[model samples]
Every structure is written in C-alpha cells, then in structure tokens.
Target: MNKIIYIGMDVHSSNFTLCSFEPGYGMSEDKIFGQVQFKDDLIKNTAKYICNLKSQRKDIDIVCGYEAGCLGYVPYRELTRSGINCKIIAPSTMAVQKGGKKLKK
Candidate 1:
C-alpha cells in the first residue's frame, strides 16, 4: 500500500513556507520544511525536496498544494512538470476553524 505525504505551501513573492503532513490514521504529525528563499529555480528545488522524500520512503507519494494567487500558475506548472501531483486551492473555498485564522505555535 502506498502512503501519502500531503504538502501545504504558503508562497510569497520572496519565499515559500512548506509543511508536510503524514496521516497516521487518526494520529497525524506535521513536519515543517521551513521557509525557502524564492528564486528562479525555487520550484525546481521544491520538486527536488519532494523527490528526496520519495527516495527515502519508496512507499510514499507526495501531493503539494498552495493558494491560488500572486504567483499564479507557475508553481502548478513546474510541480506537474516535475511529475508531482499538485493542487491550487481557491482562497474563498477554504474552510475556517471556529476561531477563524490565528498564528500560534
């Protein structure tokens, strides 16, 4: 059976903040990849990171996603070109928690 590594990205004009979640049935843990400086080949580097994870765990598949804004389709195109499954989520369609949105550690 293939396990999934779901990656969520908070992309900005100058950097990208990535977090990977591995669902352990009902006990999941999230691993933060931290902020990677934005550059011409940043998307390629992101793909390479995903590839590395795949290499370490052959039974896993990665799915990356980011909000649909600012940078536009470039990320989606690059990730797909690198053969990783990627999704672009609309901001309005996102489900918010009871407290709305908050920054907490």
Candidate 2:
C-alpha cells in the first residue's frame, strides 16, 4: 500500500495551497488548486489529485486540515463525506501570524 500522507492546506477565497508530508520525510512540493465556486468540481478533483499522488500504493490514508474561516464547515463536511479525514481549525486560535512581516504558519 502507498504510505499515508498528512496534508496541510492554506485556504483562501479563490484557491488553496497544499503541502504533503510523509511520516519519515519532509513535505513535498506545494500544489495549488483553484476554486471557482464552493462545493463544485474542486472537491472531486482534489480527491483525484491525492489519489494520483499515492497511486502506486494499494491504499492511502489522508488526514487534512485547513484554517477555519468564512467558508464555514461546508468544505470540511463535504471532504469527510468523501472519506477524507478533515479538520477545520480556527485561525486566531493558532500561533500563526498573518499581519507580521515574518509570517509563519
């Protein structure tokens, strides 16, 4: 089976930046997925994209999370229903700084 990877996403109104991480190794290249509208092809295409990344494995486990924002829980609900482990995190609750010059996530 292909190894399960942890996915971290930087969510925005128009698009998403995703980074993949293996258990023992570091994160892979960042991938950007555009969202023309909520609850559309983006969900399906994202699932497909992840599958492609772990295609060689018999199965994969994906745990994903994004900062909770104006989009609400719709995106999280949709993704979990599709069998992906997803979480919505409050941005202010985290230590990530947005306004500072040296931004960190």
Top candidate, metric lDDT: 1
In the range 1-105, model 2's lDDT, one tens digit per residue, is 655567776666666667776564456543333222333366666666656665655566777788878778876887788777888877666764466542223
Tell me how far the alpha carbon of residue 70 in candidate 2 is from the true structure, in angstroms, after superposition. 1.3
lDDT string, candidate 1, 12-49, tens digits = 77777677777677676544544444455678778887
TM-score of 1: 0.80
How close to the true structure is residue 23 of candidate 1, measured as C-alpha lDDT? 67
TM-score of each: 0.80, 0.63
Give the clashing residue pairs of candidate 2, or none. 1-58, 2-57
Candidate 2: C-alpha lDDT: 0.64
**Stretches of candidate 2 above 4 Å error?**
1-4, 25-40, 97-105
Q: Please give the distance, in angstroms, between residue 22's alpha carbon in candidate 2 and its true position after superposition.
A: 1.5
